[model samples]
Target: MTDHPNSIHQFKVKLINGTEKKLSDYKGKVILIVNTATGCGFAPQLKELETLKNLFKDQDFEVLAFPSNDFGRQEPLNGVDIEEYCAVNHGVSFPMFDKVMVRGSEAHPLYHFLTKISTPRWNFHKYLVNKEGEVEDYFFPFTKPLSSKIKKKIQKLL
Candidate 1:
């Protein structure tokens, strides 16, 4: 998880509260990174992330939700308001980061590091990063967060 050119651990991200977080801090943890849109139909899936976080809270697993407006102009809310909306509406308790462009030229560097294979086709796209900071798998937007496949992979990663 050192600063290998392709390691996800080398990047840092901004939280919704404007706090800086080093990805290296999560070196030994499995991470589920999801590009979120509050106004998208898949918004309900936020609850599944919360459920997953709670289910594995005692383990070295973390759910990192990133609000993005890249698709359909969704996720109009920003900062703490966006966090609040997701919590109140979808019971999302996982950490949410600042709004970020998850694709295209303006994409966040973390997204760049993650999309070396493929980019998020739409909202709610999920990426599974193993404890070693390597991407183990990717789930498309159509894949439900609570699907057996996702959970099974997560359990395997854990």
Candidate 2:
């Protein structure tokens, strides 16, 4: 496991299926971590994220999605329901976690660590972490996942 305390690899998160995942497991890979809400107006970005995931499947890249109800209660689905909706509707192929508060007192520790770098203003906000498990940069909620800027950063990290 990574020894750096400031690194994202130090954190653990729960999957929708209740499996515990260590961020360290994603070592040496560029990761795009996003807080998503299936009901948000920007829900279309889910499809775009899936497209990006597919585009980089041959490389050491991953898109990890976390469902959040922090904004407008936009993500009403929980657990597997959230997973099914993303798959059936947006064809999301990335790993999705259980619903969690992305901001404020109840925010997950990983989100708190990330907020130390940049905070999510709304659903779909994304953090681009480099292969070393440090937050390289972040995108506003509205930034399309497959935008040239996002893709370029991912390529640069890869």
Candidate 3:
């Protein structure tokens, strides 16, 4: 129970491979946290996200994808299946977490904090976090990962 609004340091989420990773591990990196759905209209953004990762590999930037089934039941795959689909279909190379609800009472703690500060309008919503563990801003589901807005912000943070 932390009082700081942007303090994600205490949160721990599971990787796609079932390993627990503490948010603190990414303490000094700019993190783009996204709630994704495998079967949603915005699913193609996965490739754009990968492009962003490749574009900023030299910088201290990273994208942490969390597969969610909260919107229209779009993400129907389990943890293992989600990983496989992302790898095979999107060629996703960035780290992906286990499928978790991004909305509702059973949402993950990370989502709880994200939605508390800024609500996600739909699947593929992204929350940008600065290196110091502060929420920089929220991007809607339709916002492309490679958009100029995101690119500028990434540049500013890097």
2-37, model 2: which lDDT tens digit per residue? 443688899999999999999999999999999999
Clash count for candidate 3 is 0
Q: What is each predicted model's overall lDDT from 0 to 1?
A: 0.90, 0.93, 0.88
Residue 91 lDDT (model 3)? 85
Q: What is the lDDT of candidate 2?
A: 0.93
User: In terms of lDDT, which candidate is strongest?
Assistant: 2
Model 1: per-residue lDDT, tens digit, 1-158?
34445668888899999999988889999999999999999998999889988888898999999999999998888899999999899998888999999998999999987888679989999999999988999999989887999989989989
Question: Residue 94's C-alpha lDDT in candidate 3?
Answer: 92
Give candidate 1's error at residue 23 in angstroms: 0.8
| Alpha carbon lDDT at 105, candidate 1 | 90
Model 1 alpha-carbon miss at residue 66, Å: 0.7
Q: Candidate 2 at residue 88, lDDT?
A: 98
List runs of model 3 lying over 4 Å from the truth.
Answer: 1-5
lDDT of 3 by residue, 11-76 (tens): 888998899998999998998999998999999999999999989988889999999888899998
